[model samples]
Target: MIHSVLEFLTDELNTFIKLKVGDPTTTRIYLSGVTNEAGIAIPDQSLGISLINIEEERVNKDQQNRFVNAVGKVEKRNPEIRLNLYVLITANFQNKNPNNSSDDYVEGLKQLSYAISFFQSKNVFTPENSPGLGSFDPNLQKIVVELYSYSFEQLYNFWSVVGAKYLPSVLYKIKTISIQENAVLEQGEPIEQIFTQSQHKS
Candidate 1:
């Protein structure tokens, strides 16, 4: 489910960028991170969406785990876990010439700005609004994206943990992904009546 959500975002953002750049078949946005086998924090001349953190949304939890099935049998299942993913989008574009790297540097900033604009225009995604999302995961009913701000210290710590230098980037909080399993922990037949025991006075 997490993979599907990220892929959906990447595809949507990539389309928006292609339209803005007036180029078809332009693939720039991708699901990636600073830490990779190649040790490249950011790919050259592309935007990488990375999952930086995940937090469980503890508010408004459903504790009810038992329900009657269609066959009138009692069934018990664990409640789903709701999660919020902190995603970082980084743009890394560098020119071949180290001396003339300013152009690519600015280009990276422009790409990053495009990402911000795309999310600003449309932050909430539902099946009604985004039909493609249905193909990704029918269970994915809704997704909300919000700009996440960070303090200078926090930013520094993040970059340090990533083991890479900072690039033009933005952070977003992707909300409310549910995880549940179908295995029933317990099952039983529905009780139809209550039995009473009678005893003599002695």
Candidate 2:
């Protein structure tokens, strides 16, 4: 299920965002297979809501090297445009206890909301001049914010419909949704370590 979602997202992003395979300006999005966890354990519930834990795959060493090389090429070609990539990980929880209970699903939605809020609050690209400023350039910020918001909203709606059909008592629990600046994993360094450190709030 999670795999299908990842593939779907990849396809959508690829089509929406202009990118060539080897272009540094291109954002490479990868998804990690679902985590092997039983489900979210809620108090008072005998059986927890069954969940499909989906995480973003850490950028591997090879990918980092390729990105570094790509950046170099992109810099030579177009130095003005600063390339940035973002990764978002979402976990979905659905009731599989046979009995219909919306509590767990509600909790999952709350978790997802919190995660989105957290991401929004920590957005470093926000401008100081305006309250709704999203990026350094006001015009660019407006476009980016609108595009991101619309894309995410569409995804959420699509997911809601899919969840309704597959798992009626569905709840989505999102963990860490992070954006790393100038991300490049050094050789021999573990990708996990890099992501872990980057995700940590200062």
> Candidate 1 has what TM-score?
0.90
Candidate 2 clashing pairs, residues 3+ apart or interchain: none
Clashes of 1: 0
Best by TM-score: 1
Q: How displaced is residue 195 in candidate 2, in Å?
A: 54
Candidate achieving the largest lDDT: 1
The RMSD of every model to the true structure, in order and in angstroms, is: 2.4, 20.6
- What candidate 2 gets wrong by more than 4 Å, as runs, is 1-81, 84-91, 98-103, 125-147, 151-202
Instruction: Looking at model 1, report the run of 10 residues with the lowest lDDT sum.
Output: 94-103
Off by over 4 Å in 1: 97-103, 191-202
lDDT per residue for candidate 1 within 1-202, as digits (tens), equals 9999999999999999988878778687889876775665556778899998999999998888988999999999998899999999998775655675533788788888999999999999999999999999999999999999999999999888877777778999999999887679999998889999999996
TM-score of each: 0.90, 0.27
